[model samples]
Every structure is written in structure tokens, then in C-alpha cells.
Target chain A: MTEELLRLDGVSMQYGTGETRVTALSGIDLTVSRGELVAVMGASGSGKSTLLTVAGGLTTPTSGEVIVEGNWLSQLSPRQLATLRRRSLGFVFQDFNLIPSLTVLENVTLPLELDGFPGKRAKRPGLDALASVELLDKADRYPVDLSGGQQQRVAIARAVVGGRSLILADEPTGALDSTTGEVVLRMLRSRVDAGAGGILVTHDARHAAWADRIVFIRDGRLVDEAQTPPVTTLFEGADR
Target chain B: MSIRQSFLAILDQGACYGYQLRAEFDRRTGSTWPLNIGQIYSTLDRLERDGLVERTEADDSDHVYYAITPTGHDEVAQWLVSPVVRSTAAPRDELAMKLAIAITLPGVDITALIQAQRQATLRNLQELTRAKRAGGDGGAGDDLSWQLVIDSLIFQAEAEVRWLDHSETRLVRAKASGLAEPMPIDETRARRGRPARGGVPIDGKARA
Candidate 1:
């Protein structure tokens, strides 16, 4: 029995029916087990986004299996898939995407409310997640009032609340300054320490440096995957 | 994790000489990481001094092999889940520093620096491509190690060339549109986005 929390078995996703169709993923096989922090990197139009979306169950694959937490996503109904995504998975986008009108607390607790978690009790984990990203002090602030990096932290806080075991961040730091990006990355890295698995999709190798292993994708295929030592500092402008 | 703990973790797997440790580390990582033998020996000496490893002389071997102690085993387990301070020193991490400095100079052309880096990277990429095909090492024992290092370096150099090419284009467009100066934040408020505190501009001389 594999302890893999997420698995993709020979998966392929094709957009459109035929003729003018596009193949987004081809024969993809990947596994991310518990407590792993993996990064997905590829050039533009390399189908990295398709892989992330398919892995997170945002879209069905054209063929093969998408498994999470021991259940194949393809076997589930749409409603059940939605339920699974909401309860078991979290997402951080490049834009930070914190609701401008909501206070940081509200944003963090939004997923919990959607999942019918008791809001009052949810606040504790929400606060802890915020603190993990070093943005606890901004909890009472609105997204409009916070800097881009701070807002991204709030987004991360929302992602990890409710004890969700897997986090999928798509270019989460692309909008921030490098220094702030490093802080957000550290927070994500700490999630592995806190017993959650993460998959980060980014074009930034420096941002990907936080990951324990890097899986490179090119032309909708897994070109290479390699384990790396922990990064103590950002590698954006490395000289050596 | 402490250096001693890291040393023990590497040795607790089995007895190894300095070269063997370096080789194993490189091999396990698919040759993406290379640990120098000198660094391994120095770390072993420190571990021996700390009583975490016992150095036993081996017959007909110039290098002593080290075996981890009981304390070392316990330390390795602790280190597996330890909250390690991300190591700050990587040989190739000047980009973050450059980005941090760019924000300080409100109107300087960051693209200029990116271009310079891209040009240098492309030259290196060409050299590595030639080396990959030439098999210039005469098939030495360490030849594979050199090739692995070169491959990673080539990959990295190509990645950089691609990044700088893209970054410069976007930045050049931004500059042409009168958005050359990056958005600035107060040093105290700029935790991860901006450079080190106090808006220090990295000029050519400064980078040098």
C-alpha cells in the first residue's frame, strides 16, 4: 500500500473534442505522498497549469486516474468531487485573491463557513495559520489595507485552515517582491513541518527552491524529478 | 539542524570515508548536489570531537572510516523532523539580492543587469554544450562527477538565460510605459518582498 496522498496514473487531458483540439497533458504519472513538498516547473504552454488543475480536481482528465486520499476522483460524481475539493484541498493563487471587502479573518474563515464548520471554533486554526505566515497582526485588516505580500499570507492562511492536508499554490508569489515572496515560501515550507503536503506550481525556480523535491514538466510530460536539500535562503539571484 | 546532526545522519547509514560520503551524497541526489571531500572531512572531525562518531583505522586504507555512535543514531532521528533554519548560503543565490537592491534605486534600469547576466549565462551554456559532446575528461573516475556538475550548471545557466530574457522584455515594456521604478514600500513594512532593510541600491560597483 502506497501512502501517497495524491497520485496521477498515466493521466491525459485534452481540450476540445477533435480537429482543433489541444492536448494539455499526456501520459502523466506522478505521486505526492504525505508530508511532501513538491514543485512543478515548466515553460509557458508546457501544460503545467493543466497538470495542477487536473491534480486538484478542477477538471477531469481525458483518460487515466486522478487519485487523492485513496479515492479516485474520476469515480466520484461532480457534487462529490466538489465536496472532496472543498473539504480536503486548499489553493493559493498568484494574485493573492483575498476578497477586498472581507477582513483577513473573514477571508481565512470563508472556506470553513462554506464547508459548514462552526465559525467560532474555526477562528483558532485560522489565527494559527495566519501566524505561521507571520501575518497574524494583519488579521483584522482588509486586503485593500495590506501589502501584496501580507495579502498573500492571508491567502495562505485561508488555504491551510480547517486542517486541510494538501495545499496547491499556483505562482502564489509571482505578484510580490522577492523578499516577501521568500517569507510566504517559508510559511508554505513550514506546512510540511506541520504535517501537511504541498504542491507548488511556478515558473520561478527561486520560489520553487522551498520545495523538498522539484518535478519538471515540459510538453505535458514529466521530464525529470529530483530531491534537493532544504533551502535556507532564496536562490533568485544566486551567483555560484 | 546542527552541522553535527547532519554529519551523523549521513554517517549513521553506514561506515564511510570522506570521499565515499561525498560520492554517496552526490549519487543519492542524482548528482544534482556535490559535497566537497574537504568539507566532509572537516565535518567528520567535528563529529569525532563531539563523540558522536568513533574513528576506526582500517587495514590498507589511508583514510579512516567513521562509524556513528548510539548518541549519533538518536540525533539522526531528531534531525529527520527538526525545524531547520533554511541554510542561507547557496553558491548561486545572487538574484534575490539583486532584486532586493533594484527597488531602492527608483529609476535605475534593472533590465540592464538582467541582460548582462543573460549574456554571460548564454556563453556558459554554449561552453557546457560543447563539453557535453566532447567528453573532455578522458574517462577519469571523477569524470562522471564533473559531467553531472556540468549538466546541472548547464541546466541552471539555461534557465537563467530564459528568465532574464523574459524578465528584461517585460521590464523593458514597463519602463517604456513609464513604469520603470518598481513599487516601493517602507523598509519596516517590506518583510519578504523588498531587499534587506533600508533601501540599499546595488549599483554595478556594489554588485561587483
Candidate 2:
């Protein structure tokens, strides 16, 4: 059996109280195990982003329990929670949020450095992540010097650096062209296949088709879940 | 497309012998639908009989060719401008019929049936994707048509995948909500020489 990296049991998040109150999530139960990528698809204002935020332990849920690697998040002190996030989680965003002044290698190594690993010790993993995305040659180049697609690739490199166990991506391909978007998704898929868990928040079905399973959200509730058929079944009867 | 109309459309470009027309048709469609030389000759013969084409002068190789007449040109223009109308009569779609029957039949695994069809559709989608990727520089002559044909196939396969997803969801919902369980057959009605209500005869004719 694969290791379970993340679990949310009946998680619900609400903002404000009384007339202005908003429920961002309602009784959400989700699990992400090693080597699996689950895609969350929904319309705008449907709580997909909130679900990610709560799962990452960036926001405390109003009710219900969130367990990460068998530890209840509510029991962890703020400092311990911060340490857990730094050591176990990675995030990729739609905007390719790399500091314009930082070189690709510096940006990727920043996470490891922030976690108190020596700069010299962080360099090898940073370089490995960049090479995995075929962007090592651009390691010395600044973010502003790269194309939008290349910048996104660098962001991906930063996410998987240091063997982060859980990846949370929100519209990771939203800013790229169709072909470039496919490249980003392919990279994400490869990483998840290599044993990391992932949750991809996207609205595009074609992109979600690459995930192990797709979860549909509506009105802040999971309305459906579809397991993508095996690749063998999907390509059955194909003329090879 | 009607063979009569296809012949006229091809002849509108220039005069061609039956075999040449057959080859052109195959090339333009990416051989998605191959035409037999015999079928092309028969279609040409009918077009000539209807005065839409006439024999042209034999070339140096002594090969007979036919050119489109004014009527044929007008017909081709009309056909091009007209939108294709879908017939109201149900098409003989094997997949649709199989699913419809499976839902009402006993012990048929509807999920498995739908899954098999979805797999086949996805396979077709992959093949079309490969074809599109291999067809580079679609701006070249003849490449444009092939590209468009592949695009049509891709769109169709994507739609099929979407529909299969929808059908599976609906099926699961129906089962969970107790809406799709087969109703018990009335023995009296079965014993009578009468067809069940809501069930159409295979020939589409009313029973006496």
C-alpha cells in the first residue's frame, strides 16, 4: 500500500459571521497518497482554492480534522506547522511567481536555504530539479530574462526541489499557450509518477485528463469523482 | 457526402478521368473514406447521363477525361453554399443502440459496455492526435484539407469522451437513486401476442 501524504476529514471553512458569512468549503473529505495526482475542477468562487489552502495547512479549517502524514494539523504549534510545510510541501501557481531579481538556481534553492540547510548542501538538489525540467542550462539566468513558459518551468523546478512530498498547484498552466501548457502538465505528471502526491486545481478537462482521478466541485461541495481509465484501456483498439 | 455531389465538386476544379477523380477524393479526405474505382466510374456515368458533365478531348496518352458542364458547376456551388441538414430519423448507430438495449435488458453490465466504447473512442482520439502532430506545415497545398479533416476527427473524439463521462455519471446516479432498475415483465402481456409498450418493433412497423 502507498503512503498517505494528506487527508481532510469533513473539512469546512467559513469567513466572517452572520449576514456577511461565506462558506468556502463544506464537509470536504479528500486524500492524496503517494504517486497519485488528483485534479480539482470547478467554476470560479467554488472553493477549489480554499480547499488547497486548507489542505496545505495555510488556513485553519473552522471544523473537522486535517491530518498530514498521520499528524493532526491542529495539534502542531505554529512553528512546527511552518517547519512541516517547509519540509514536506511545495506550491506552484498560475503566475509563475519567481522573484524577477533572483536567478533560476537561487530561486529554487531559496526554499532549502529558508529551512536552514546550508547553501552549499542545497545547490545539488536545486540543480537536479532544474535538470529534471530540462532547464539547468538557464540556471544562471534571471526570471525576467526567460520566456513565460521557461519561467513556469523554473517555478516547477522550485516546487519539486528537495523531494517535497506533496505538491499543490493552482491553475499552473493558465498563463501558457496550449502547447506550452501541455509541457508543464507533462512535467507535473512525471513528478507525481515518481512517487510524490499532487493536487491540481484546474478548470480545463484536457489538462485534468492527465491526472489519476478528477474531482468535480460545485457550490463548495465535491459533486463527482471520476477515475481516469488505465492508459491501456484508454488506448485500447488503437492502431499502433 | 453523396457520391453524385462529390463527383461534381471534384469535376468543378478541372476535367479528370474516373481513376484520377477516385485518387483525388482519397487524397483530399486523408483516406478516411476510400472510394473504389468502380464506384467512381458509376458515379461519373450517372453525372454524364444527367448532362452535368461531358467528355473532353483525349490527352496525348489517349486517356478520356470529363469536364463539368454549366449545370454541374451550378450544382457544386449550390451544394457548397447549403448547410447539411440532419435527418430526423434515427441513425443506425451501433453504440447508441447497444447502450439503449443494455439498459433495459437483463444481466447486461451497462458499465462495462460504456467503458469499452469509451476506450475505443479514446484510442481513436490518440490516433488522430498522432496524425495531427505528424502533419507539419499545414499551410502547404493539400495539407490544409488533411489538417482540417484531422481537426474534425479530434473534436469528434473529444466530444465522445465528454459524452461518455456524462453517461457514466448519469448511470451511476440512476443506480444510486433507484431510477434504472428493470421493471418486472407482465406475464399476461408477454403471453398475449402483443409488443411491450415503449418498445419499438425492429422493423419500425406497428403490430397488427
The candidate that achieves the highest lDDT relative to the unseen native structure: 2
User: For candidate 2, lDDT tens digit of each residue in B33-152?
Assistant: 666677788888889999999988788988789999999999999999998887646678777777776787778888777656755665455455545545653668878888777766
Where does candidate 1 chain B have its weakest 10-residue lDDT segment? B199-208
Docking class for model 1 is incorrect
For candidate 1, write residues A23-142 as lDDT tens digits: 889999988877788888777898988888998999899999999888899899988898889877889899987888889998998888888878898788889888877788888888
TM-score against native, each model? 0.54, 0.61
Question: Best candidate, TM-score-wise?
Answer: 2
Task: List chain B TM-scores, each candidate.
Answer: 0.53, 0.83
Q: Which portions of model 2 miss their true places by more than 4 Å? A: A231-240, B1-208
Error of 2 at A31 (Å): 0.8
Which candidate tops DockQ?
Answer: 2
**Chain A TM-score vs. truth, each candidate:** 0.91, 0.96
lDDT on C-alpha atoms for all candidate structures:
0.74, 0.82
lDDT of 2 at A225: 72
Instruction: For each candidate, report its DockQ versus the true two-chain complex.
Output: 0.02, 0.07
